[model samples]
Target: MLKKLLIANRGEIAVRVIRTAKALGYRTVAVYSEADANAMHTEIADEAVCIGPAQVAASYLNADVILEAARKTGADCIHPGYGFLSENADFSNACKEAGIVFVGPPASAIELMGSKRRSKIAMQKAGVPVVPGYEGDNASDDELIAAAAGIGYPLMIKASAGGGGRGMRLVEKESDLAENIKRARSESKQAFGDDELILERAVIEPRHVEIQIFADRHGNAVYLGERDCSIQRRHQKVVEEAPSPFVTPELRAAMGDAAVKAALACNYEGAGTVEFLVDKDRNFYFLEMNTRLQVEHPVTELITGQDLVSWQMTVAEGLPLPLAQNEIELNGHAIEVRLYAEDPSNGFTPQTGPLHIFKPAEGEGLRFDTGVRSGDEVTPHYDPMLAKVIAWGENRDEARRRLIRALEDTTVFGVTTNRYFLSRIIADSKFGAGEATTAFLQQEFSEDPSLQPAKLNIRQLALAAGVLAHGTVGEQAWSNAPATITPMKLDTGESTVELLVHNKDNVLSCRLGDQHHEIVLASIEKDTLCIIDNGIRQRCQYHRDGDSLYLQAFGESWSVTDLTHQPAAGANGAGSGRIQASMDGAIIDVLAEPGQTVRQGDTLVILEAMKMEHPVKADCDGVVSEILTKKGDQVKRKQLLVEITTN
Candidate 1:
């Protein structure tokens, strides 16, 4: 067994590996960046080291620094958890050269499977069915454009070295192919350092199911099970479940066999996942092989009753397969939802801030895998995934219901999240019937009103007013004088609402325009407000940050700003011409130059954040009067990037 193990990653994954490694009697070391100085992973490990700054390139991806930390800590094995350098061939080689065990596949296997182009060819030779298109070495712009003619319209240009939807684009017609290809290459180069791309005939409305395969050094391998990751946004999985509802035993066996064959063909070892796109007719084609433990591994663990991380360690120590194919049994159903610090109402933009209350629901058959707590900071230097909530049950419906209840009770107050959105997806009729496909979010759930952020209703506004005046109301609880009427103003994102509020004997009367509400405050404990709105008792969670308040009610989160005491209005050039950064990010591209004429909605700058690119477009047609920010500049949210004089 490995003596000392170091985790070359951060967040929930690093915390996950550390717990498992320690439980298996291996001394665990954690590596972190400046931004993670006080992260939970660093705090829990037996030993910790600061590798570099907040940026990933200078920290998590700095293999040399990570290796040096391992050497100093006397760690004999390094586990590159899911992201960062987990699948980097060169990093694996470097670990081997340093006489340290890389707890993953061999360098050769990684190199071969890392490239989608090469992997597709290798899979073809191995008799695994693959989506037909182009994976040739001729990757020049013109070559790709020419290949599109042969592949026909409605094809996917995918980054050869990409996963999680980065550097992937769908071209519906010939005219859009060239531009999408350029975008794919640029994004791929920034993400994977290799701009090589592969074209595949788009498999419309297919179910994305991946088989989990584990191999040992002694030429033994077995398939654990399959996971359905069909519901997606921007090509990334939003919800995942084990023992795919859409896959029958026959399809599962075939996919498992193919996944095992693909693993063996590349001489793979340790834990890996072979993904496939299964059409409506049950025809499955090779997608890509993720050469690391997936984020959704908990769902598999719940169904199979196995510790995959421990298995990875066992394989790293040259142990044979834990169990044969016949010994493995898929027992129960498990569902998982990714809890992200993102605004689902606003294009899923990543959110960063202090976590005022990061409490996940606790119950039977519920598991919360998280690395941050109430006081931990969510930074912009990494992915915004805060936690993974997995629920297990005896049947699929039980699991689904448990997941929905857990999601509703989960609280993440300070930062915006998709907590409600995840519940809505699982509760939807289409998803309940397991009919979701890769296009489910765009095709089915796009216009679902429940998926959008909840606007404050009259009851919620009354609750907010009562909560806002809780302290003062409590002080005047026994006062005999008539209740004082106070006028206040609140900005509810949609529009400003002026309200009249006063508390008498713990009952508050609030009037917004012509609407009047009588709310009785019952109790206030640790941010949970219990109030009776017109005789109906309600409990909701809220967090107040200065004048800005966030409330969690009605299975959705609402933001309100107390603008009562502030100045009312001012004329501004917000929508007329100024192009502002929508979020805090680094400028990766500047498309507009000063004095250039551009149309409204024309993209002027590209901002990269949280491993995704967002285009800052011109809000109005005009001549570009100034290019305030250039490429490589770090900008804050709402910072002016361009000044356009409207026509």
Candidate 2:
């Protein structure tokens, strides 16, 4: 049943494993990474290769260039579609020493659940309810602060070979546990060269849930129940669902029989998952085990009509276990979300460029697993997750009202996403009463920035002031035409705005303060502009440059300029350059060196990017005259890294 396969991994889970490996008739292949040469899963695979130079250690964690692009695309099975080299147990023992077929699991079960301290000591010797922490192997920082005061003070030090939330931390005092255990062992030795750690007990208001175990090659496993994922932020996940508006049905049959006894205590096969955490009294624990395939597995494939990449290619062809555990019937509520170019009012950051209007969100229980379209290019090299947006219904309040109408009928445009912060956390009310957690976006919308929504819309500022006061020469630019007024300048605080135009029968009547409306233009060419009203069309995007216009929408972006050509204000809100590097990272530590004097919010340089870190401070009183990128170089976006001299 496995005629071809190969994926290895790129965006949107390699276009969701080439649509179920072409609906199970297999033949896929893909691979990519010359910054995804023309991406979209390298133009819908069926065979494609390139494998290197876009740095994921020379392309998606190399592994001998993905086993020579699956032995030069003859494939026969590879599919590691979760993060690079998906759960690499030496890339599944180098695709079983090159005889290929590593659809997932078994590199001795990804080296016993890819080591989070040996999957919490094999889910506490498979009785399954683990998480009281301290996976001993003592690394002495006062013996991990007396094992985080014997696993108590809001603990969690994690990183015994961490995953996405990289090398964790959370202390909460014992005098900040020896500088957060030396910054989680220097970010777990710079992200998993394993600086070894483990302390646990941080659960307050947690939720994560998981379970999706599948196995085969004879040891048959089953469970595909839970999924919640508590809409997290720093600890990663951004919305995910599937049967969990706070799990039940007897806690989904006891976390699906403790996630199939933690995947038969690692004799696991094909797709994996397990995870857990729970807590608001429904109790649950064991939080590790994700050997592969999950970036919210399409909300467990829209509540289990199942297609987990065609059940990981029918359990890697060794097939068996084709649904049992009460024939797994979970048919309703789904959800998903995770669009992410990032920038939920800043601190979510990431955001790169070109996706100029990429639509998404279609009907019948919407899906969209996407890998970027409409002119692609969202580079900073990877994982800015350009698409997931699931939905499905029949329950959980119709899957949170169809995922807030599929995040307001999504419509990305050049970067900056979070699609209105996932439609304000699915029109939150403690996430519509199921009361989410992972600190639910820092406990109900971090200090309220008007609880999120409003990414501008007064019908998109009256269709960008009726396309700059009707300049499409519609009804002959309003007959007598003398009415070509402009005055725009309103960057969210609205200081100016006067636009007024008139184009009769061909309709375009505008006016911006006394309200008049009736735009309906729907397409203007050269930098595009689509308008419409009442039937709601709004698609304004323009770049122009010489007279400055910018505009963009739904992925928020703005700029207007043309203040009658001029520059006047400058009372120290400074912006001419120097103090650069706002992304494209790697510097990780400088803290002012050159002449070093520093003051006003000092920190000076840290950088890192994408896999997180960030610092770079000193914006007022300073001296350090020029550090200009050092600790590990790489630099780029706005590229300066340090210069300071406020003399």
Candidate 3:
């Protein structure tokens, strides 16, 4: 039996495993990078060790270093949480050689199921229906192009050794195949260290359903319902729910049996997920098998009433199945959304900064799993996902509504986030109707008005003016004097507005561009502001840092800047001939140099951050005047990379 557990990952997953391991009477050790010195996981573990630098290759993915940390901490077992080296077969073998139990399946199973090409071939032999595609060993661009001819257009190119949308692309025409293949290969090599590509026929409008299966050392396996992860952006899951609304009782059993067969094919043990694409007619085909716990496991846990981490421990100790397949039961419905530090309006580009205020709403049936707290810095060295918000109810609509409310009430300031975007998705008509498929985001909700950042209205402007005026203790000395008119100028990124405020008798009268209003400040405590806006009692949450303020109200969030004291004189706007870095990242490629002629929309530089690539392009036809960055240099957001003299 294991007495000490070491987590071989970071962020929320590491914290999650440490909590469960401590409750089971085992001492837990946490391994972190130098960048994560003050991270939440390190603070909660019984013992903490710094493995290496912030780059994953130097830390989390460094199997040798992680093993050494476990040995130094006297940990007898290691839990490879999903991501970094979770599906690495060599890491599993190394733990066995070191005489430490790895809380996952055997090395042989991981090796077989880790490759999408190999797994699809294995599933075909195991009598499981597989997607029609090419899974050959030859991954050359020429070979893949030839295979695309046979598979036809509108097929998918996937990285053989990767998942989670990395190294994946949808090819719609013959003309677009080669470029997409090149991009797919490049992304695959960067993300998984494998440039192998596979071709598959795209399943149109299919529901992304996956079965959760668990096995023990003994010959027993059972499936725990299913999770519908059809709602996605860029093939990354945005929302996931348990007991899919599209799955019937009969269909669920069939998919579950197939998942168990796939698990038993490689002599699998521990937690695994088998994903499938189910057509409108209910025909399901194998997609891929995830050989570790999934990010959306909370939904399954809420429905099945089981702690999967505890089961992993029991199975690692060579136990039998906890319950028979027939005895397993699922109840209620649960939905979850991934809260990320990103700007949805700007193509969901990742954002990084200090988290001045991070608070999850508290309520029954609500579960928040997070890794950071107030004042934590969101760096570009790791994934931008901040937390997971899950809600459970007796039915689907109830769960959806509860999730919507939770996302709206949750507060995250300092950096831009997708809190409001997530609320809009959950409240969308198609999502509320339980009719969303994989094409929901692209085909149906592509033009959603809520995708843009909220515009500052007069009401919110009045409230901001009132908040700015309320805290002035010295200014109140002029109560006996006539009404004092204070001028304020605020910028909301999208636009700017100026207003005049007069404070008298706890009422703030404000004027903006010939419009007048009165806002009564009912009360103010900490960050919460309770006010009566035009006879309507409402509340808003805010965080102030000097002249900058972040506010959340009316189901939207806004960042207001005080520009009253700053003088501005320039016609320079977005197309100012200056290309700036969108976020802090490493410069992978510099496409332009001094004296180079460029056209509008030409790629100037490419930056890699949060495990993805972002290209900075020219905004107008021009000649490059200066290039400030080079390959391999780290840069900050809004830092100038290239300057061009426009025509």
lDDT of 1 at 539: 90
Quote each prediction's TM-score.
0.89, 0.33, 0.91
Q: Is candidate 1 or candidate 3 better by TM-score?
A: 3
Give the per-residue lDDT digits (tens) of candidate 1, residues 448-475.
7655665677777887787777644334
Q: Residue pairs in steric clash, candidate 3?
A: none
Model 1 quality (TM-score)? 0.89
What's the CA RMSD for each of the models? Answer: 4.3, 22.9, 3.6
Give each model's whole-structure lDDT: 0.88, 0.74, 0.89
Which lDDT value does model 1 have at 551? 83
Error of 3 at 298 (Å): 0.4
- lDDT per residue (tens digit) for residues 422-461 in model 3: 8888999998888999999998888886676667778888
Off by over 4 Å in 3: 139-153, 173-183, 472-481, 514-517, 567-583, 587-608, 612-647
List the candidates ranked by lDDT, beginning with the highest.
3, 1, 2
Best by lDDT: 3
User: RMSD (Cα, Å) of candidate 2?
Assistant: 22.9
